[model samples]
Target chain A: MAERILVLAEQLEGQLTDVTLELIGVARRLAAPRGSTVDALVLGEGVSALAATVPADRTLLMEHPALRLFNPEAAQRALEAVARETSPWLVLVPNTSLGMDVAAAVATRLGWPLVAYCQAIEERDGQLVATSQLFGGKILADCPVGTDHAVISVLAGAFSSEAAAPEPPARIERLAPPAELDGLRVRAVGLERPEAADVDITRAEKIVAVGRGIESKENLELAEELAEGLGAVVAASRPLVDAGWLPRSRQVGKSGLKVKPRLYLALGISGAPEHLEGMRDAELIIAVNTDPKAPIFDVAHYGVVADLFEVAEALQERLGG
Target chain B: MTLAVILKQVPDVVEELAIDPSGTDLDRDSVSYVVNEFDEHALEEALLLREATGEDVVVVGVDTTGELDQALYTALAKGAQRAVKLVGDVEGSWLSTRALAGLLAPVIRELSPRLVLTGVQAPDDLDGQLAPTLGALLDWPHTGVVVGTELADGLVRVRKELWGGIMLDLELATPAVLGIQAARATPRYVPVGRVRQAMRESTIEEVEVETPVESAPKLSRLRAPEAAGRAEMLTGSPSDVVERILEILRARGLY
Candidate 1:
């Protein structure tokens, strides 16, 4: 019998999280050496359609109204049922807040060893080991699971999404969650989705981000106008987020969204490693700052050594934006 | 009311770290250690909570190594009433949140704090796993990235930061574990006078506990991430730099 690895799939409303696909890519790599099959455990209402998208040889779909909103208790019971049935060698989960909640509960109940935020994983000496960056990516730590069964939560964007194999005996099975909604002590009374305007920066292909050098909120209009003219979005460093000048979502750093775009224009942004990690993937980076020795210049494809206000105005005129 | 804050002593994040000559572990000799930054925020939250409720707060350090004494003492200087250190030298690989929680559950059970606070993620692990694992181990409620917190009617109302700056208001029963995110309130530095007093009077109670099982994730191999595509270095006056940038942007079809 070939070893099997199970991936716990998460969905919001009807769309799968990007992490699900990333986990599939990870599982494919983990399973290749052992000729193992990947199985996806999806729990939610109206999830049969999602089964087609899971990159697994088999999918266990648990459909229930209670599972719709990611109730931890019900989700745990459903996963426990699947684990009992499949007995996978490893259980892979996304490292999102929600995923960690479920993964922790399940691992605790099963008494299985777990490694969280794994950046890399491999089998060595017939035992699985994983590596994760520690100290804010300053130090790397290598760990090995002592138990035969291991649970791991993978960081988002650590691996790019890969297409699921064309077709290979894909089977779907329904599981009835063992717990009831009423049994869940914690309930989400309401969910407030951010308005499109609030998250607009995440999708903007061209972004104009400022750092502490921007000085004050009154000067923000300079950055905003440049963004407006260039048809770009405005973002900020952690200080701006702390200052309430920008929302936390618009804060670009290791703790914030890792963004990749066509063009990233940084203004007065000193390139801290935390900030650089988030935008290092952008295709073209342009930095404008007064200081010639700003670290931003190191990663920037293009840099302007001048006052940001003067540079923004001149660039706006030249680009006709 | 009593609050407990969990903290870890991790290598300084800003310093350049080197691996041991053995290539199997960090070069501990050269690395300076500090309290994990997030844990500082957690400690801050614990102090704030104590002040709000006039509760006695005891900070506990589950030290797997003797190195944690300084961190514990620092927490004491910051306002924790007492400190408890668990001693062992378990390998870094066995330091997963689950394993750490297993070691901490007993100590926490004995203390029986009304609430436990931790950093959303440690600067060392950055996994953000500790709070959830501790919650599961204790069968308590867990909340992550909490920006605002209030105690009302014996329940904890936590404001969690969701995607895109939205807040999720959650109410959990007492005996909850909250992973605090950095908020508008900056963590205060320990006053020099308080540090001196704490060092003079504070003595950490050492609790010897069984070392956690070695469950380090195996690392097959590691290499630095491939260098990003090189940027053409432009050296000239500001106008010349601008012209060169425009030319490059146009070449890349940005214009």
Candidate 2:
């Protein structure tokens, strides 16, 4: 039998996530060089439609009503079982919040070396080598996992979803969750979306994005006014969205939205590499930061070293009502 | 209940980092290190637990740069009941997650803490793998990207951040590790006077830990990110800056 590369496909609300396909895409690349075939392991009720779309050589589906909502302990149990059955060369999972929670446990249960948040994978001298960023992308490390079985959770957006090509519907197989999941301790109560994002900033010609420097939720109106004056949409970095000051769709970053606006105006943003990756393509970049040395200034075409509130008001006044 | 908070010191991102001449690691002579932002939140979470339930919080760190003693002292000043520094072969934080996990599992078992907390991810190692690896090594459950948490009836109710505005409310049993993203509130600040007092009164306990041989990722090169664009620095009055912005926007036919 050909060595197999197993991918743990993630799904939500009965639909597959983009990161799942990205994982498959990475698995395909890693497997192609080894003469290995890729397979997908999906767990959720009524998920056949979603699993069928996996472009792997085989799709292993474990459907159960209890899995409609993700429970890490239960999923880990299922994945542990799947690993034992296939004894795959490597298991690839997306590095999302849920994936991170389960992948570690599965690797531990099976006693396999695991690498998390990998950015690139290359086969070197019959060994699987994965590269991942450390220290907030300041350093990249190349990890070599010996030919022995290993599990890897890949960073989201590190591989392009476009790289995933659809193949003939994969061969389907049914698996079973462990008979006893008593060892599993964590249980997910529910999924909550506090606010629905209403704006799509990807198509915006101009975007005004704010970061933690904005200070308070009330101050978001200042960004809104500036965005309004510039005929731009209002967006934010991850912190603002995490704090619920803005909806998820308005978040512009690796885990949020990747935007290529014509003009990008940043306020109080420190320009973390992840946030910069999403907006570096703007034709005209403007930044307002209180600190003159903020990293955001490096990419801004025009920079203001002053309070964002003061800058927003002055610009709003200059543009008139 | 005892809780272990793992603290890591990262190079202050505010300062410019340069690659060493060898191009294999960060230029250490010019770098100043500070507590990682999220680790502060983890410390704050432990302190909050101390405040609420009077749990003993033990702050643990691998002494990498010989600077961990001062960090542990700061943690003592902030409310950690005990501080420990693992005193050998930290290798400037180059140890792989597996190595670190191997080292911590023994310490955690000796401490017998009900919970272990670490920053969701370190600024340098944005991988967020340490906590989970520690959990796996200990054969305990672990969760990451946790923003808020509560303890009730010997269970941890955590609010985990999922992608795209989704939040998962999970109940994890005791002896679990949490990769804390933030505390329930901002980390409490300690005055210089208190830290100085701690320096005089507290001694960081040293524990020698031996890690098994392990393979770490190879860093072939290190370099600064290329500038995507250059900014025209704007100075002067706020009105001047605003007017300059307007003129440029108008020239570009934007507004």
Candidate 3:
């Protein structure tokens, strides 16, 4: 039998996350050499609608009323059942919060080797090796999973989703979760969605980010004004985000979004490596800070050493927005 | 209710780490160590739980090196009643999940902590394997990156931070392992007096490093990333600078 790679595709209210497609892209890379096939396992209420989107040879759908939202127990049981039946060579998942939980639970249950936050993976010496960042993006560690069945969670945006060619005929299979998990004990009561204002900036282009030098919440308006003038979005440093001045989505750092945008402008931002990891892939990076030695300058394509407010006002006047 | 907080000493986040010429391990000489930041939140959560319930709290450092004394002392300053360091040689040891599970199984059996808390991921390796590995060994319930937690009727109710800060509330049975996220709580600073007191009383026990069930994976190469060129200083009158930036962006296809 040809080797098989399983993708635990995550979705919300029936809509597949972008990370799923990204995983498919990664799976394509891993499966191409071995002539292996990629299978996407989706679990949720009304998840059959996503069958058309997944780029897999087969799409396994487990739809139940209890799974309308993410029921960890049910989801795990379903994925585990599929793994038991398929015996895939590797299991791929996104490194999103839910993906991380499912991957951890599944890996633990099966005693399988797991590599998280994987940016890249490739086959070597008949084993799969993954590249991951360590020491908060200061070091890169390449780890190889020795087991025949390895599980990995790939970071979002780590690999670009390639357009499928000569699209394969996707087949959908319905699965019933295991029944012995009755006493799992965890119950979900409610779900709360973040306000619309708190959107993830990693997906955004033309970002105007503020750092600690912004002084106060009142000064945040200046950055916002510049953002508005540029028709851009607003983001913040870890300190501002931790202080709740901005939503977690707008926080750019190692712990936050890993973004690649068309234009990223840093205003009064002292660049920390953690913050830069989230935005280092920006096509054009412009930093404005009074300190000449600010670390942000190291990655910036353009640097301006000046007062942020004055610089903002000058740019606003020039743009005349 | 007795609480146990697990801490790990890891490499500092800011250092530029290099791999040894051997291509198999990190160059330890160039790195400095610090308590994993998320683990600090785990310690804080334990302290808060103790304060709320008036329960005794013990901090345990799973130290693979004698150097973890500094981290253990820091935990003591943060209000831990006692600190125990599990000393062993973890270097060049793949420290596979099976081995870790085996080692912690005995400790959990002996400690019998009502709840065990650890960081979601350590900064040095960022493998995020410990909590799940330990949970499997003890056959306990496990939750990762929990933002809100409550203890009631021997059950642990937690609000997990899902993608984009979406909240998923769950109720788990006691004797569970929680891998806490850094955003869960504000870590408390250790006091000077407490540090001095902890240094005097803390006892560390060295244990043999468990042999990994699987051998260390081979590394083909290790190299530092090439440094990018210095940024171009776009200096001119304000309008001219803007025009210059626009030109650069356009040429670079950023526009």
Candidate 4:
């Protein structure tokens, strides 16, 4: 195999994810600058046929029974096997739930340096420089990766997945699974889908979403009162859900639920990127936080820097609560 | 059988983080430290597992911030059998996640643990690489985003969440590494008095280990996320703010 930009194509339940295309798009950009080619790696049992549409210079599809499902152990082995032989200068993996599972392991296995949570990748002075987010997107760090081989995990949504006007890879190579996948230490027993939300925030017309600023669980009652006045559903940020103050169904964020209600009343949510990704499209956004710098204010159309308790209480009173 | 939980002290995000003169790291002098949230969850999971299986739970951490003692003592107060602090400059300009894992892997292997748990992700190791890196170095299977774990015959059954909140049940052989996202239950709160007593009684075991050769990604700059500047400020007291909010909603015919 020739040296090129390698991309780990992501798929779920036999369908390729849009993020994989986004990775390919990024891989193309990174490869074009240096006249390097791009190779997409797809590891699965019967999903290799799906690689026909990958927008790369070449596609290397590996298959094994252990890869019938998305097992990190098997996926890592396949990626490491391919990377060892191809010796790609740059490898891109989607910074997603599954990608997070395997990217670091693959990099470590290959003895290559890795930069995770990378939102931007650019080569400077013949060196790979990546801008990665830290502190849940509160801070951005631009760093230079190793000179030799580097693995980059690209976060989704940084680039659009418009399908690149439909250009498929010209060459496809089918490879046998490495013997390492024969008897994996880890095996997926089964998968469980998320339980139906008690009240689906996605369909709700109005939502009163509270965050850490709610302080204690008792304050949730204030949000409830305000929600009732507005005929809205009650929602919360990850902290409120993680603390068990609110049910998971009512949580709003990357790991929670994406909601775009008619009106989103954000109280005390710092609006981490994960949280913002879930609810930045609300028809009307009103945010209240003690800190004027809260990212929620950036997304909110009308912002107030005030104590959440006072604001919620006053809003309830104004609404005849 | 033992479950080793790795603890770390990260800059408390609540504080105003100031970039150091290096422009790549935080201004440590101004920042306060707190237990990494996920590691606390890791310890909580290990403790919970120990409560059921009677397996010993040991807490270990690298004293990068020089404040690892408080975290270790609190772990002891919360029912860990022992605490280890690897104290030394493990070959780095700073303690990168890879270096921290390299430094701890040898010592953890010496303990002969059945399972090792750490936070799935920290602000510093936002990619959640500690578990996988340690696993790779130790030649053990590793997984992240794990929420629940149970001990069975010779392996551990874990409940992990995949993308879009899909849950999956997987079984990994013993001597596995887990990057815990959350525990089955909330972390138990130890009384301040209990922590004080633990500090007075328990002694943290210290060991010196030399990390193998590794190159870490060198950060060149750090900056705050750019604000969108889309918000229209609504000023005044609580009542006035509420009035403006009501007016906005009414304009959208939401009321």
Judged by DockQ cut-offs, is candidate 3 incorrect, acceptable, medium or high? acceptable
Strongest candidate by DockQ: 4
| Model number with the top lDDT | 4
TM-score of each: 0.80, 0.85, 0.83, 0.94
Worst 10-residue lDDT window, candidate 4 chain A: A161-170
Q: Tell me the tens digit of each residue's lDDT in model 4 across A1-321.
A: 325888999887678887798888887776665788889998777876687777788989887888877888988888998889988988889877788878888887787778888878777777677988887566788878653688888877767676343475447899978998988999988788878867888899999999999889988888888889999999998777878888778878766777889999999988877788789888889998998767788789989998888888888888884
Per-residue C-alpha lDDT of model 2 across residues B31-104, encoded as one tens digit per residue:
88998888888899888877877889999988766788788888999989899888776646556566666777
Q: Judging by DockQ, tell me the better candidate of 1 and 4.
A: 4
> Which stretches of candidate 2 lie above 4 Å from their native place?
A64-66, A104-115, A122-129, A143-148, A180-182, A196-206, A212-225, A240-251, A254-263, A273-321, B91-93, B126-128, B215-219, B223-254
lDDT of 1 by residue, B1-255 (tens): 688888877677456666666665566677777777777878887888777887777777766445777777777888888898877666233265666777888998898888898877775443336787788778787867777777776677777765445555677778888888764376778777787788799888877877756533334333232335334455565556667767876787766
The residue ranges of model 3 lying beyond 4 angstroms of the native Cα positions read A64-66, A123-128, A145-147, A163-166, A198-206, A211-234, A253-262, A267-283, A287-321, B91-102, B201-220, B225-255
lDDT of 3 by residue, A69-160 (tens): 77665666677788988999889887766776667668778867777777778777786678765455445567776538878878776777
Question: CA lDDT of each candidate?
Answer: 0.72, 0.79, 0.72, 0.83
- Candidate 3 pairs with clashing backbones: none
CAPRI verdict on model 1? acceptable
1 or 3, greater by TM-score: 3
Alpha-carbon shift of residue A71 in model 2 (angstroms): 2.2
